[model samples]
Target: MKLLAVDDARARILAEIAALPAETVPLARSIGRVLAEDVAAVRDQPPFAASAMDGWAVRSADCPGSLKIVGESAAGHGFEGRVGAGEAVRIFTGAAVPAGCDAIVIQEDATREGETVLVPAIAAGRSVRPAAGDFKAGAVLLTRGTRIDPWRLSLAASAGRAEVSVGGRARVALLSTGEEIVQAPATPGPFQIYDSGSPALAEMVESWGGTAVRARPVRDELDAVIAALRDADAELIVTVGGASVGDHDLVRAAAVVLGLSLRVESVNVRPGKPTFFGVLGDGRRLLGLPGNPASAFVCAEMFLKPILSAYQGAPTAPATMPARLAEALPANGSREHWMRAKLTYADGGVSVRPYRDQDSSLISVFAASDALMRRMPGAQAAEAGTVVEVLPLSRA
Candidate 1:
């Protein structure tokens, strides 16, 4: 297989993958989800003209001068009396802007004297008086395809939407394939390794807003692999390890047997060149990530994240930022390098320094990385102070 550029590979992968359809979720359970339908205001916000302050709600025409204080309107309680010419009604914040009232004279701007208060030009030269539909009774507040964060949920709740229709969570089936792979926290024999990639990848799926339905290890036998994949019953199947040339690499053979059309076989990217993507005959998507933990993680971040985003109708883009190289970098024209690095702010912009060692098999390097410093194929050794594309792993 010929090695493809990173952008070209990514573009092709995204094009082949399909987004998951939308589904309705209760408002209480909608947070951290994505909206599939546009959310408009069901009713007027505040449901009535409301006071902006705790001061008296009086005719703006009479706010500049003192008038008799008739009754107090606190929040839920509204004044029944009409404010005749030269009269004012005291009102609190959020109280309905009463009839015949145009402005609120703040208590700080007025001096109280028994039943009457002295006030000065609170409404002069200002249209401070709020009108009906100040926030619009039925405005289209939130558009469709919105990611439902805490703030978005609050907005929907405030807009009187008790339930929201959101994009269905992507169902994921995670398989760890290898005869030598054992479930983690186990007393593994010297020949066996704990299955760290499955759990790690599962957490990654959950973090990307998908529900991980299966995280079990599958033996190297092709039948066992097929059975595991069949039992998963997920919209997307993520297989870790056993994707390479070894005899135990049954994921590729199984995918081919399952009638998955290969999308991209190889890419010119370090640590993840052998990553594979395909779609099953039944339309379920498949990703063949490298078995090495670091390689698997990098491939997951590069391919799986965008797939999940597209499934949820969320936008996905590589997080690129300008950063100066903190140290000299070696040139590798054979493959595009994805160097694990730490990014720090220096002199006015960010500076990225690659980790001392970046072997695909070393998970510790990946765990310590705060960013991925990308050097394109055929590029020269990056000199200190050279600007390059840095994908931030940690926002801070």
Candidate 2:
């Protein structure tokens, strides 16, 4: 099988997936969910010309003169009568400005004398929040494909939306395969180690807005792996380990027996060259990851994150930012490399420094890393001050 570039593999995987169907959920529960339809304002914000400060509503022409206090307008209650010439209405903050009033004179700028007030000159529309100041009725405030956050939820609430239509969360099944691996809390034999990848991967899937369904670790037998794959109930199946051509790697053979049509056989990237993607006979997608902890982590960021984003109708591109290199780096080899690194923020700029040890099995190294510094294939050596691209790990 020919090795595929990272971008080509990602593109092919995304092409086989589509956004999940839309479902209506309460506005308060829609945070972190992608919008499936546009949300329009039901009524004008404020809905009327209102006062912005605790003051007196008066005609601009009548200000700077003594005037009789006609009535008071508190929030949720308006002064019914209009503000005639030489008269004023006591208005509190957020109160609707009385009819025929063109401006508000703050209480600080006025003196009250037993039903009469003396105010300073004020301009029309001063201290008055015009109707529809924030938004007008029927105006679209939230568009489709937008992920709802606290601020967006506030906006939707202000638009009078009690419920919103959002994309359904994608259900992902996680399967781990290995004969020498045992689940935690159980004593392992001398040659067996506890499984670690699936637990972390499940949390990653949830953090990326997908529902993770974890299956028990399966032994390397072909039938066991096949049965596990067949029993997974999800739109996407993520298999950890058993992707290489070793004798114990039975995931590929079992998938073939289940009618796997390969889309990506392998990737040409350091530490994750054995990563593969395909579609099963039942029309579900499968992503095979390397068993090494660091390799699996890096490939999840490189491919699985984007796949999950596509499934939720969110932007499918990795968000990479530019930063200066804090230390010198040697020229890259024939394959692309994503070096785990730490990030520093100082002097209004970001700097990245790659760790000296980048072994695939070092879970400690990955735990300490907050960013991945990218180096293209055959790239020249970089100086300390050279600018480079980096992808931020959300957990950092």
Candidate 3:
């Protein structure tokens, strides 16, 4: 089989992930969900010209003289009377500016004496928030595919939107194959290992805005693996371990039995070469990950994240930022490398130091790594302080 370049493999996988369907959800529960349509402002922000400071509202021309304080306005309660010439209304922050008031003198800038106050001159619009200032009615506050974070959701709510139409969450099924893969909470027998990858991948999926359901582990038999694959009903089915074509591997054999159309056979990347992706019968996507726990985690960070991020019609382009190397490294060979590394935030971007041991099965190393120091295929070696590229790894 031809070893696919890392970029080529990523492109192949990205090309196949179409956007999921949309749904309407309340604003309270819309965090991390992508918008299916533009969120338009239903009403004007501030709704009325309001005071932005706790002071007296008066016509700009009435400043520098004593003005009678007629009424007081506080948040949620408006002073209904108007501010006539030589008159001022005491107003709090976010309170509506009474009629005929054009400027607000902050409390610190005014000297109050019982029912009258002397204030300094201020510009016409000083400390006053005009109607439709933040966002006008019918304006698009959030565009399509905007991820509804806390701030965005707050903006939407303030714009009079009680609910929004958001893209459906991507449902992912995680399958951990091989008899050696026993799930946690159950002690493994001698020569058996816990199914650590599926749970970790599930948490990663949730963090990336996808829902993951882990199926029970299967023995290293083609028939058993095929049964599990048949039962998976999610949009994407991910199988951990037993993916390589080794004599003991059963994942690829099961996919073959299910007539999965292969888009990628192997990748030219260290620790993740055995990773593959394809479409099974019935249009569900399949991703075959290597057996090593850390290898599977790295591949998930490199591939699964991008796939899920693009499942809402907005394809997230892979990001690589420049970083200074904190430690020296050796030359890279034919396969591209994603060395587990730690990041020290610096002036511009970050400083990265690769872990000493890069073995595929080191889960502890992978856990401690916050960045992946990327090396292009056959790249030359470099010393400390050399600029390099890195991709952030999110285990949470």
Candidate 4:
């Protein structure tokens, strides 16, 4: 297959994507979750006309003159008596609007003398009558697919929601295959290597609230690989490494042998061009991530992370920010590049310094970096001051 540009490949992959339906969750646990249903206010935000300042509430007409104080109203308390002409009700912040009150005169603008309070004309001039529906009642307050950030949580609490519906977590199976691979703590001779990608990938999935059960590692044998792929109960299977054209590369061949329809053979991107994606004969998803540590992670973010988010009804894409280059980036003319980098803010924008070692196989850069800077293939060089897009590393 011919190489596909990053945008084309992304569009193709995303075309196959759909967010899962929402599920009900307790409000307490719903923070950081996505809303599966549109959230409407059960009632007005304040529910009643309440004071916004720590001042006296009085009938606006009675202000600018001394009025006999009928009673005092504080938050949670209501003044029962109606304020007649030349009469006032002393009220505190958040106090219910008294029966005949139209506005509030702050305490600073009032002089207290016994039961009568004198409110300055200037204070009366600035008083405001909070209108009904200052915040609408029974209106859509949050949209479906909205992620429950702190503000959303507060809004839900204000809207009197004890529980809400959200998208369910995604389920995935993580598999890594190679004959030379051994579990960590196994002393490796020069030829034998540790299988660290599966564990790391599993952790990444779990951080996103997705369950990533580790499939048993199989030797390079095709039968074992196919068997392992079939054993996973997850909605998607993530296979690490063995995606290239080397004679040992069995993932692509096994996928074909299993009758999985290939969606994409490769994407025009550096560190992860040999990526593969398909659907198995049984309709299970198959994703082949490049073996390089960086490439594997980039593929996971580009493909797997979005899938997980959609499953959970994540409201938006992963956070991205404008970052300046700390060092000159050589122009990429062949494939879009995802450079692992550390970010800092100096002037008004972020500055990204690429990791010294950009080798796809190195794991230390993944650990040390906080962000990824994207450079499209055939794009011009990024000067030290050019603003570029940065995808923050997942904290999960």
Best by TM-score: 3
lDDT score for candidate 1 against the true structure: 0.79
Q: Estimate each model's TM-score.
A: 0.81, 0.86, 0.92, 0.79
Residue-level lDDT tens digits of model 3 in 237-337: 99898888888888877887778999999999997999999998788899999989878987887788888878866767557788999988889999999
Candidate 4 residue lDDT tens string, 239-302: 9988888888888888777788878889888789998787888877778898777899987887
- Misplaced by over 4 Å in model 2 are 54-58, 65-81, 86-93, 104-118, 179-196, 345-348, 364-368
Could you give me the TM-score of model 3 versus the true structure?
0.92
**Root-mean-square deviation of Cα positions for candidate 1 versus the true structure, in angstroms:** 3.7
Error of 1 at 292 (Å): 3.1
RMSD of each: 3.7, 3.0, 2.2, 4.0
* Alpha-carbon local distance difference test for all models: 0.79, 0.92, 0.88, 0.78
Clashes of 4: 1
Ranking 1 against 4 by lDDT, winner? 1
Predict model 3's lDDT versus the native. Answer: 0.88
Q: What's model 1's lDDT at 82?
A: 69
User: Of the pair 2 and 4, which is ahead by TM-score?
Assistant: 2
The alpha-carbon lDDT assigned to residue 127 of candidate 2 equals 96
The better-scoring model by TM-score among 1 and 3 is 3
Q: Where does the lowest 10-residue lDDT sum fall in candidate 4?
A: 122-131
In model 4, the Cα lDDT at residue 225 comes to 78
For residue 101, what is the lDDT in candidate 2?
Answer: 97
Stretches off by above 4 angstroms in model 4 are 18-22, 29-36, 60-93, 102-134, 165-168, 179-200, 203-209, 216-221, 247-249, 309-323, 344-351, 393-396
